[model samples]
Target chain A: MKPSQRLLVLLFSGTAALRGGGFFDTLDDKTRFDSDALGLHADLSFMTDATLYVPELPAQGLLTSDDHVFFVPRLMTFFDAQMGDRLTLHTQMRADRGFDPGAVPDGDVRLDEYYLQGRILRDDDLNVRVGKFGTAFGSWAKRSLSWNNPFVTAPMAYEDVLTVSDRKLAPSGVKFAQRRDLPDNKTNWLPILWGPAYTTGLSVSDRIDWVEYAFEVKNASISSSPEVWDAAQVGFPTNPTFTGRVGLRPAPEWSLGTSVSHGTYLQDSTASLLPVGSSVNDFTQTTWGIDAGYEHGRWQIWSELIGTRFEVPWVGALEAVSGFVEAKYKITADLWTAFRWNQAAFGDVPGLDISWDRNGWRSDIAFGWRVSENIQTKLQYSLGDKSGREPEGNHLGALQLIMKF
Target chain B: MKPLPTLLLVFAGVHALIADGTIEGKLSVESMKPSPSRPGYLPSPTKQPVLKPESAPAIVYLERDDGVYPRTKTNETVRIRQSGYQFRPSMVAIQTGTKVDFPNLDEEFHNVFSCSKAKHFDLGRFRKEEASPEVLFNKPGVVKIYCEIHQHMRCFVVVLDTPWFVKTDAEGKFSLNNIPPGDYSLKIFQPSERLIQQRVTVTDGQTNTVNLTR
Candidate 1:
């Protein structure tokens, strides 16, 4: 009477005989096991969004404001388990409110990802994983999940909105702000890679035969730092960061990829913007990308291009470049329609007398509506532009609603 | 005593008309190409051409150590349906105690299941204004069918405890009427070929062909 209580009494009498069809009439053909040997899947969702900002603007400081906003940003929850046919264990968790960047609406609960995979050799085609994951890079940060995003924001090379620092007042008054020099700076809507883009240690991945690869080392660098989500109060690093990716798949509905990453994304508490004796490997941060996709039967398409640099030992090499090209179409079987366009560019940063808006672009157009296999709903509209910004051009409108269980 | 039961029913009606007999076949498929269309926004090629299993129809049967073969009492009911998301007669063969009927002419909600070691039911999700869920297969072999929330919705059913099955046309031709005078053992079942078996001999009113190339 105790093999895990006889497997919870044979899983509640086989879910009461799968509700009278007699245990799926002698079950065992698979796909309804949420737990056959210690399983427990879950992926709960609940989102709500709304944004509007057309012909309005005025707030300028802690990173621009003034337009319209609506809440319930997300309420995610994952959980996954399956500790058997080669071990596993995952976890996500979220909760939000409104404006997010380095996230601080302070309602708590964030924990993003937690890994622990394993499934090494013997034709399982390798796999290794070890703790805080996500960042196998490219193909949109592990499919920016909101039910595998077809779009609801994400992809300006995985999210953008920059600026990073600005503040002034010194001459005996003191207020300091040189974290890589900024002057009138403002525009930190943030997310050029952050949000379940988690990081923090060993990964390994495999899938030979049409190629697929991954390699990680982690513990910081995909920017938006706070140790990329509290790496135990900023500690471990004598050198870590090193991401990777390699995909291929030519046909079975095409795919193609390439990604890379490097190290030291600054932070010994910014060491006063380095060079008083320089160190953290003299400040580095590289990146690289290229992606592609194509589905079929109801269309789908994707594309990417990315690039990033940074160097900086006293402010020198700064670069950026992003790309995008989405698509989707399904128009019934529960509708869908999408389109994207993204763009970005940036470079020039010699002594930084600063006047840098350095290009930006966007263009969306969505419309989803599944309303059933666990509800969905979307509506988007965008058009942006920023080249030495001052409201150079903008108009957005979003609306989302997702529900799953 | 009533003329000895009318001479044993006129010698069982002349042994059922000299055991009928008529097998005929065709089923080729060697280099069988055709598979290149699939790039998205569909719907508009409908001059009929979407009965899957690589172009539908193919199931021939007949195997005999001679014993259990008497269940032919039809009111005919095979149906299948579920339109648009397909499954309409993706292939069927029946006769072991047939009575299929699925129906759910699509306004969504389908469920149909089948685990197929010969049989394993499941019809759950139903709806489409209800009423139409029959089953009665009585085992014999190939079941397949699916649609548990449309994972591509396929179909296959093939049953057969010998009423001498047949089902081919789409140019693969077949015909198997009243075959009961023979050495039998023919099988065929094509879905990407291979599984053919032979050995035939049905004489009495004659008509036995059986080609089946590659």
Candidate 2:
């Protein structure tokens, strides 16, 4: 960011500096119930966040001019039901960012997850989940909800624009790399790891002593968005993405985990764009990450480091590293503050100084207040700096109010 | 519903006939804090409770070293009622050996229990508007009460060794009449406040008007 923007952000987020934590309660008795004799229980919770933001419109990047000084109101609903002690069902529905065309207030609603889980062991030492589920590649997916996550926006690895595309292969490596500078590359440019990355899949996870592990076979890669998560819209487990994770909790307050995923990064639509003899499977994206967290009392510390390598038809390969370290503390029973330092750095081509994507660093700070037992309000500010770019515009100020019942 | 003080006055019939003194006082609590045993919540229950701070009552009693102090009648019974989502007065003071009746007034099931060190007991679940099995108070200390299903609902049972205890009204007024002439120790108990103790001399047929604020 430029000097003026830096000063603006510092002045904007200075009051939220004493980073802290709280796990908010966003569910009520009316929305949750238990039947002991029937061995049944269910809960339905809704979270709505209204964000007023100042978007730095990159010339040829993800944010458009329409994003400047606008309010993006979004709502998400979660449903969970359990039968007996071993079988459970879960689902998530969302309506956000104006899913409708022309940025209309009439947003389209989408179902993000509908899955069933069964604990094979009486002690839950062995468990299996089938149907649509979030990719088991990282821990970020676990805390993506408004009540669990301290920040409004996701980490850079999960939301920042990447030079790689799943819908269309870059015409040329040089041109692919150039698009990150000053061009309109909307949905065509994908994030290294999409938000939640809820893909159609089946996974088997188990907990043994202090260690937990899981493996998943999904229809699409981590970069695939909501539009291609279903089997009909994408591949049906034919050489699908493979994800696995292993976590260890040696103590009640600290957790350490690592994950790996390898998958074909191209869609069927790209079949027509490949060379005469090349197949969609020729290109792939592989990612591995490590996550760590320490939560004791009112202080919580979280960190994740991800390394990804994508092979393109023209560009032999592009590698990048993205991650973040965040901390939050509960200043009081009703108030909390948090701060995150995140960045995405791409490796330079073999001989050229240009990387596959623009390297950027960003800092997000937020303060949250509990308005009541069922409501919370968060004020957040983000400062971003893009390397080798013009019209440096990546500063945003947002206020989000969430009411759950 | 200042139930205990009214009951204490009636129960004082045996001691009022003798040469006695009276103690009346005004009490005000600066804050009504959460129960110490309240389980830690994710977003801890923000702010002080909304249990109407102005209605927080004080229980004041006198403990005397005089050997002739009257003993409470064995099996003396007292009734504390439950209505809506709360205990009728939310608190009460009673002498040891008193038999307490906890009757559910709401047309719903309610479980009365206390994990207090003074007296640990669970009255079990009662049917709609059913009378609870009598719980005899044989110990002298504060017993915090709760319902199994409704975590927010709470009540306190202050068991006293002396029968000269009375609770304050909404205006922080309380009167302890018909006390035996003697040197006594004044003790006060508030569920949300610290225990307060003071020394006093009760002269025959005299009224001691004392006031306290914290």
Candidate 3:
């Protein structure tokens, strides 16, 4: 056997002697890895979802012309190496497929998170994390895993589409025109905020008594499209984006917090969209939100309100406000029922006539069953309504199965 | 001759006072501030209720001096029930060589384990209808127990070589009956409180009352 394998076997033997049996005999439920061992540990989990969408009216823009059904699958793998008790390395990779409504099915694999975390002063009082990781802005980002989240989809604030394309088109193919007859002006394609939900950054966090706080600096702005950093583009912004959050525990069953992010949103290639010789900082995006959660007995509830403002040069100013409240009740030890209301309001751009920019809201209801410790199934139905769209309302049904190991 | 006989009888009676005594005490705390609660995020069920710190009981015992007391045998099985995601009798006092049976009374699965100095054992996950395995604790010290799946579930077991120990009631009252008359060190243990020790003396066939406050 290899040296590492022999070493692992010896370590397990010693642990068994100390613990009186195999490592799995005790089952360290908090972490997936064998924390007793100091070397590498691995974990894997996956989710498969089948969704059907039906439109109340003739579908337009990104939506297909008729009813559509597709399957979405995602796989996540994590590797953790503990150098010692004070320092550790963590890396997570994800493979996802079937998210784009207008494109053909394709699988995309990427490194979702990679970080090296260590203690600075004390284990609980102070710590520093460097590298790419999920944003520590709100409660949802930290608990968005398939097994952790009650619903299949993310919150509207994190997935709302911003702009479909860069240019507006008319019969003459004139770009950037705000005419109502322009085909591009009516296009519904838009970039979602999923990119900003994860970023490369350095964060300092601490927990003191009932309060916890974190402050981070990342390479790009909140909701910036094409999240991957390209150092070749205008020599990476000197002043990076800043995000922070503070949470408080007032009662054993309640938690309240607030988060904020501010930074330049325009890239070097998109800098000309603002004005001639305008610096990237001229178009800045700022977002702030308040979130609260409560769990007691057989009921759990979570709510958040987020507002984002974009400072543009010619298009006046634009603002988007979104909020959601979700609640779940356990019908039994293995069954749960949940409901959520999500809504968003966008300020009209002076010269733009995109229908997707209108106000929208959606309601979702779901029932979930835990078939076993490693398997869970959920059935959810959602209704959506938007003003100034061909399909003023839509219906969606989804069934998801999750497996963990 | 009758007076001499009576004197001999009194002398024998004075030396025959070997019966056990009773130690009664009330354990009170200065304040019972509730701990701040947080919503369950991962690995824990959202339906579980928070356990009030004041409702949990404390453990009280008389420390045994080596070679002064006989090693007691505990044949009766002490059961710690798990229901509503909380350990019933969150605090318990047990004699050395005692057998503890952990039964899952709730509908969900529960895995009970302790990493404390007194004993280290993990009763793997068991369902409500499954038979609970028993553990034998032979050492004497504090054993901190926790549910591997539920972070909020916690319990403490105080094991001692001597059989003279009792757990405080909800009203903070405890009675240790049939304790042999002697002078020994008394100890009180409560979660999140400082360990308390005092010298106590018991008289034969009398109930010694002690009020422990901190």
Candidate number achieving the greatest DockQ relative to the actual structure: 2
| Per-residue lDDT of candidate 1, residues B1-214 (tens digit) | 0000000000000111138766665554433322211111111111122333334566877787765676674447888887765677777888877889888766545667664557766665565657877888887777766664554456677788777777767666566777778687787776532356666777676554544443
Candidate 1 is scored at a TM of: 0.32
DockQ of the candidate models in sequence: 0.02, 0.04, 0.03
Off by over 4 Å in 2: A1-27, A59-65, A98-106, A232-237, A350-353, B1-214
Residue A110 of model 3 has an lDDT of: 65
Worst 10 residues of 3 chain B by lDDT: B1-10
Docking class of 1: incorrect
Chain B TM-scores, listed for every candidate in order, come to: 0.33, 0.74, 0.78
Question: What tier of docking accuracy does candidate 2 attain?
Answer: incorrect
Using TM-score as the measure, what is the rank order of every candidate, best first?
2, 3, 1
DockQ for candidate 1, please give it: 0.02
- Model 3 residue B34 CA deviation (Å) reads 35
List model 2 lDDT by residue over A115-147, tens digit each: 988868664457788988778887888887777
Candidate 2 or 3, higher TM-score?
Answer: 2
Q: Write the per-residue lDDT of candidate 3 for residues B42-142, one digit (tens) a residue.
A: 22222333343225566667765653556564887899988767777676788888999999877556768665556867665576767888999998877
lDDT ranking of the models:
2, 3, 1
